[model samples]
Target: MSAVDVYLADQRAAIPGPSWTRRDLLREAGDHLEDATDAYTAAGYTPTEAEALALRDFGSVDDIAPGFRDTVAIGAARRTAVLLVLVMLPQAFLWDGGIELGASAHSAAPDSGLFHVLDIIIGYVGTAGAIGALVALAVTAIGQRWLRIGRRTARLTAAWSLATAMIVPIIGFTMLTLTGGLTVLLALSALAFMAAPFALVALSAQRTLAAC
Candidate 1:
């Protein structure tokens, strides 16, 4: 394309956009490319504001940095954060069973079709809340450089992970007819994951903010 479009894309990439103006990216890129010609403009890039953003989007930096450590960190952190979400995949079904059990224990006739779906919804909501809190924590930690927050969040997530790790024991216990502890282990898992959710929300917003 022309100089204007190249600069515009660079600027857009830097600031972020499902919507943005030429002026916004221009401002975000430090407005340096305003005077350059298009062909040479997109060329000779050396990790300027725009380049950093493009790099963040996964452009190759083979000869640029010693290694793509930042990018790798970005991918891992994002995926792990996503994994927190994936961890709850079966929660809905499990929770639905819980609801159905509760209803049956009380009286099956009172339970409506809606309750089955609502049971899953309740479980998924809990899982979502925990995940959301974690994202919020990550954004505050990573973007703001909170001295202790990142470490704290990492620890908490580890705890959550460890709690879930005990699930194997629960199933093993069931196999061995010793399942009482399953409830306790699951409670621990829920607690650890629920300890932080707002942080995860922040993390989810990080990419959009950094671009701007």
Candidate 2:
């Protein structure tokens, strides 16, 4: 049998409940495995057969959550992604024309005093992005070697980071649709998109630690 096939077979046996079946394992684990294929490269384990081996080592579905509980545990993921977005919301407004909320602060002319707030906001965003990236990577590292998390959550976090990065430009443009780029609604949505990854990382890391 191919390594993936072997994984599928073992997943059925590994799961604690009888309701779990091969089809469910493939649906969840297959996607999770595909996302994790590059993990070994990150881990300094460059086995020519690393992808196959990783599939073979993938832990049980129950280890992650019940087979039927696919979306059930994702509440934590959502919260985690949100926190990461919050980290940089202020910076996002500063870089975008978002602060032009129809007030003196939004004036086109340069204001001596207000410039300080802009600098501070930008600095916080810079620091938050760097720190969040580092913490996410560390969690991902621990997640890969230890299936205690099934590491799928880490991939969700990775994909969230990539997707959130893509969202920044979209949000900047979307702000143009409104009267002021930084109207309250636009600001909230922008921040929501930006902080998505941190929510997944925070929740998964929490779950992984709790598993201990």
Best by lDDT: 2
Which stretches in model 2 have alpha-carbon errors above 4 Å? 1-64, 67-109, 141-143, 146-212
Each candidate's number of clashing pairs is 21, 9
Which digits, one per residue and each the tens of the lDDT, describe model 1 over residues 1-212?
Answer: 64345545553444331133324334543344443333233676533544444434433323322222233223333444555555454444432454332233232322455545544554455565456536744653464464423333433444443343333223222322221233454444434443233234334334323322
Among all windows of 10 consecutive residues in model 2, the one with the lowest summed lDDT is 67-76
Q: Which stretches of candidate 1 lie over 4 Å from their true place?
A: 1-67, 89-133, 136-163, 166-176, 179-212
> Pairs clashing in candidate 2?
80-198, 80-199, 80-200, 81-196, 81-198, 81-199, 81-200, 84-195, 85-195
lDDT of 2 by residue, 30-141 (tens): 7777556667757776644666657656754456445323332233333344455554455445444565432322423234444455445445545655466555645544
After TM-score superposition, what is the CA distance of residue 59 in candidate 1 from its true location, in Å?
14
C-alpha lDDT values of all predictions: 0.39, 0.47
